[model samples]
Target: MTSTDAASPLDFPPTPAVILAGGLARRIGGGDKPMREIGGQTILNRVIARLAPQCCGLILNANGNPARFAAFGLPVVADSVADFPGPLAGILAALDWAAEQRSGIQWIVSTPGDCPFLPRDLVARLHNAQGEQDAELAVAVSDERAHPVIGLWNVRLRDELRQALISEGVRKVDRWTARYRLAAVSWPTAPFDPFFNINTTDDLAEAERLVALDATAA
Candidate 1:
């Protein structure tokens, strides 16, 4: 636990993953950003494909109509905090959902729905870093920037998170994470960053190009 070296994936517990799809999407004209297509597949599909294998269970954190995401075949849980408090609320909801529905799940990994290129070893790396730092939580970093929403959360902290969201009015992810011991695991950006998110039509177009190139190589 003293070193930051990667640990075997089996060393981690059965962690569930939740895709945060409840954003307002104001940048992309207000719709489910994960629904946007990349190389003939929805961004959600690609995210699920990458994360499903690493997690014990997978769910979608989406606000508003859950029926739209039915095609993905994941249990969609909406934010428990009203008024779209932000991704923190979605994370809180995911934690609560896991606690209630998935017995024996202690950790819940969260990723933004728009991030189709999430790392294949995301859960493993985050858990490894968490153990190495002896921290309660771990977040993903790339190009020296931290993606707070993309992290591993201890389900035991859900109650504190709920209070922070409702009573303390905390909306920023970093603001909430700062209260805990955290580990930041950095990933190389070469060949493209795994945490790259689609926020606009331009990003979607670029993702199409990247996916197409990957398909050609495959």
Candidate 2:
């Protein structure tokens, strides 16, 4: 459904969320893009602030030493697949983690770590759209572009995803999602794109500007 659709009062169970941060970040230099600063706060900090209240729990999907994220106090999970297959691998890791640690949770939401201005209603909107459309998966859309990486995923699909990544070599999120009854939920990009991500030094500067604009508006 489009962002112009009427709002619903429906409430849903809080789904667990995973922040995908395992990218190589070659364009912005080889380090965590979420660790960069915007308005004196790290992008990762901002992402956590927006997502924590909307989720039952949060986990960071990052490779290498988990201790680097110790201060965040999140359970850092590495991809189970070899050679950093891509964001799908991170999603797989999250699904496995949720199944093992949160047996009662049947679904989880995933977002890129670089997106600091994620919509507060992301989880609720995705779940609502998925239920209304009878979709097996739901992804966020902004400015008419589908963001496959930022979406709600069914936990039971972990095994299938593992097989796709390991056996079939499926690395693109949209490719696997294409196999499901997918729903695209749209959000407004007017005031600012809630899905805006930092991919380069210029985008970091723009994020700082957005932060200033947000503070002024507040």
Top lDDT prediction, candidate number: 2
lDDT of 1 by residue, 96-138 (tens): 9988988888899999999887777788888988998999999
How large an RMSD does model 1 have? 2.9
Give a tens-digit lDDT track for model 2, residues 1-218.
33434223235765889999999899999888889899999999999988887788899999999899999999999999989889999999999999899978889999999998888778888998999999999999999999999999999899999889999989899999999999999988868888999999999999998997666643
Q: What's the TM-score of every candidate structure?
A: 0.93, 0.94
* Candidate 2 TM-score versus the reference: 0.94
TM-score of model 1 vs. true structure: 0.93
The CA lDDT of each predicted structure is 0.87, 0.89
